[model samples]
Each structure stands twice: as C-alpha cells, then as structure tokens.
Target: MKQFYLSLIAFFTWVIGMAQSGGDSTRLPLTDSIQAKKSTFTIGAVYANDASYYGQRSDERLPYVALAAAYHHRSGFYLTGMGYRLLNDSARLASAYSLGAGFSFPLGKSFTADLSYDYSIYPKFSPFLQAANPHSVNLTIARESVVDLSISGDYAFGKTNDFFITPQISRDIDLFNIGRNDLVSFNPSLDMTAGTQHFYEYYQEEKGIRDSILGILMPPVLGGSPSEQNPTIKTTNRFEILSYNLKLPVSYNRNHLKLEVSGQFSLLSKQAQSQPGKVNSFFSAAFYYQF
Candidate 1:
C-alpha cells in the first residue's frame, strides 16, 4: 500500500516533467525554426488517462486536464505558464500552476541546448505528490541526425532536493501528407532515467495529517499506532536507475495547429519497487496552437 502511494507520487512527477519539456523528453518544441523570425505565442490543452513515472503507476485513476500558454521570442528566449485541474474526487477546482522561463539555442551544426527554470504553486493541502518540490532547473542537450539523441538533467528543490538524468534516442517518421501544408507523423523514443528519491521521504513525513484523520476514523488498536500506520520506507540518497521507458506519439500538424496522442510503457528497475521489475503504461492526448 505504501508502494502504491509512492507510485502515485511518481506519476505526478513524471507528468510535470512531460509538461515542462514540451511533451517530449529529449527536445524543446519552442525552439523550432518557425519561431526564429519573430516572437510566437502558443496555447495548448492536455488530458491524460493516468500518470506514471518510470514504471511506477498510480493505483487509482488520477485523470487531469491542463491548459498552458507560452511565448517564444525569435532570439530563443521563452516564458510559459500552465494550470492543472484534477478531474478526480477532489473539491479543489484548481490543482496546481507553474510558471517558467527558458532559453534555447543551437550549439553547432547538429547540436542544440536548452536551459530552463520552473516554479510550481500548489495549495497548502494539495494532494499532488510534486508539491514537495516547488522549484526546478533543467538543461537538455540534443544532437540532430538520422536518429535524434539527447540527454537531460534536472534538479528539483524545496522541501527536499532530487536530481535526475535521462538519455534518449528517437526517430520521427512521416506517415502521410495532408494537403500541402499538413502531415501526420509517428515519433518513437527510448529513454532511461536515473534519479534519487528524496522527495519520497518528504512525502512520507507529510502524510501525518492524513494519517491522523484515518486514526480518528479507525482507532489505534485497529488502525495501529501512527508510527505503524506510517512506517518509514527506507530510501537511499544515492542515485539509482529508476526505469526504462519507450514512448510512441502520433501527431497531426495542420497550419498553425498540432494535435498529438501519445502512449508510453516503462519497465521499472529494482529501485522503483512496490514489486520488483514492474511495468506501467500511460496515455494522453493534447492539442497546441500557435499564433
């Protein structure tokens, strides 16, 4: 059961990462050449069936909808904002919001780099797991070729600090063309993630209030002591391989609008264990429009 809760937390963290990276783990969408001539503004909306990080998946259906807006200058500087609303059994109309700024630029003929910072805001009693870490810095370096290759590093801090690294290889396949200006394509990527689990420790400590309520509903004798109710899940500060993930995204591009449906499967490592070697799957749909 504790592992189940941890899985829920991991899912939220993964979703936050996906949003921050412009729906792709390896590249920055805001830096495309289309926006190089002038500043561009984009608006997007997303819906996900469930959330997963690495191979850890939420036991319950934690569906959510999010709206985002971004501004990208021709010089490769950008600003973004997003708001989330959980469509679960919660009274809160708003779940969280994030504000971010970043810069993206080419390194050489084939390499590009992006650097960004994000700050997240959550309610005091927010149920989301990532509330523990409100600030993060991200850097990604990519090499364009027959197969796109990239590596990303993230450092998140607030109640606790955690670091993660992901290296990925991917290819984009154009399935067909729609008229002269539109097309459909499939993008497939494989990535491995390694990270520390300090945020899990913070989450464990923060569960006291909820556990207290549970204790009141069910007495200590039946529910056990607070310590027993919330037994410490030992975590190591050392970095460990969390999960290996494969992602497939199908996208339709028409004029200034893009629609995408994506799916991912993750195989968990020993470090992400409720059960060792777990597998999790997730799905989402999103649309973005630029002006």
Candidate 2:
C-alpha cells in the first residue's frame, strides 16, 4: 500500500511539472467518480473563492455559491442543472444558471467516452468572463491505467465562437478506509489547454464599452489618461496553448454522501495579452448527497 501511494504521488508530481514547463484548463469527466449500479439522483452545493475560464479572469474577485442537481441513469444518460449566486457587491442577485445533458459509455474494458451539451444563462452585465459563451458542446475520451488519462474537445458559442482542447492526467490515492462504505482519498490532476481567445475578446469589448460610459459620466480628472479610460485590447484569435493547471482534491465518501475540498493553481501563457505569464490560484469546497 505504501509503495502504491508513493507511485501515485510521483506520477502526479511529474505530470504537473511537465504541464508547467510546457503550458491548461479544467473540465472533469461527465460521469460521477463513484458510480452506482442503478440510477441515482444527486444534489450538491459548492462555494468557491473565484471563477475563471481557461485561466482568464476579471479584475475583481468573483466568489460564488452554487447549487446543483443531477440525475444519472443506469443507461449512461445524465441531466444536470446548476444555479449560481455571486457573493460580490454587484447589484445582480443571481449570477448564472446552467443546464446540461450528457451520455457516458464505456469504449472498452479500460476506456470510456462522454458526449455532452451545456447551455448557460447569465444576467446582463455579468462580470464573469465565461459569460461570453453561453453554449458549449464537449466530447471527452478517457483511459484508465495506473493513472487516468483523458482528452476533451469543446466548442463554445454565443457572442463569439471559441474552440478548446484539453489533455489531462490524474490519479486517486486511498487515504483511509473506515468501513466497506466509507473511505477517504486524495486526487491530483494536471491539465493543459489549447484554445482560441474570441471569448476573451468579447469580454474586453464589453468592458471597454462600460468603461467608456463611466468615463463620460465621471470627470476626466477621475479617469486618468485616454488610454486608461479606454485601453485598446489586442485579441489573438488563433488557437494556441493557453494555460497549464494543477489540481489537488481530497474527498471523503460515506455511503451516499461525498465531501470534497479542492484547490487549483494555474499558469497562464505569455501569449495572454492582459496578464501574460500570470499565476492564479482558486479554492473550493463542495458536498454531494446521492439518492
């Protein structure tokens, strides 16, 4: 058991180091980690320090609390819904809502594939960067070995269209086994993402419009230079490596309930115009009850 644990740790460290040296994004497989033999319904809640999209974020923190429900059929079809409330000082009480449907199936003994579609609804003037793209279709292929390997392709569209591809490696290490139905484990994963930044361009355009309006309302003394008031945004529409991410999640499973705490560290690519070569961290805690 000790040797197995050490091997998992070594694999996690090596993969993340490679990602940082090279350039990532976050999207887990559509199916639940702990699968049930029969159909199941799950309700969950999450609290996060901030939200980002492919490692792009707004200037201010975007903390949020979210509630989610999912129904998973034994036939591998699932439907999910989530609602988010931002904890910031913005006047918007509800930040976003999402509805998703997916089908997960085994490709073979050690491989699986998931195809999913999601639509997001965001309040007008929402500050979240991901709000620009409201519709997304994703296909993920995963392989199980000593470590899990997965790759996903996503096409997102709304105000603009963007495509992203993410490759990831992860491992789960058992920490403690209290009983047949209760256990704790640590999961570490690393991912790299390559994508087009049209969504980011949309965000900058909206921000510029808002800033211009504010500058007109406020005085020139308050708004500094013309560049400061309405800075020119350089947009890169070509697909390229965007970010690398390392994620650490510890989970406790007790029968039909699971609790998890996770943190992610992201290194943004130098090609990112506004925050080139920036590093950002995000943390979240969540719980799910399955019935």
lDDT of each: 0.73, 0.77
- State in Å the error of residue 112, model 1: 0.6
- Provide the TM-score for each candidate, comma-separated: 0.82, 0.84
- Candidate 1 regions exceeding 4 Å error are 1-35, 214-232, 273-276
Residue-by-residue lDDT tens digits, candidate 1, 1-291: 367446545643554344322222222243463225688888899898775545455334567899988999888888999998889737777788999999888899989899999999977645555567999999999897666789999998998898989998776666678788877877777788898877766554555455565463433657678566544356548788888787889988887788899998877777762334777788899888888
lDDT of 2: 0.77
Q: Which one wins on lDDT?
A: 2
- Model 1 residue 246 distance off true place after TM-score fit, in angstroms: 1.0
- Which 10-residue window in model 2 sums to the lowest lDDT? 20-29
Worst 10 residues of 1 by lDDT: 19-28
TM-score for candidate 1: 0.82
Candidate 2 deviation (Cα RMSD): 6.9
Clashing pairs in 1: none
Residue 273 in candidate 2 has what lDDT?
49
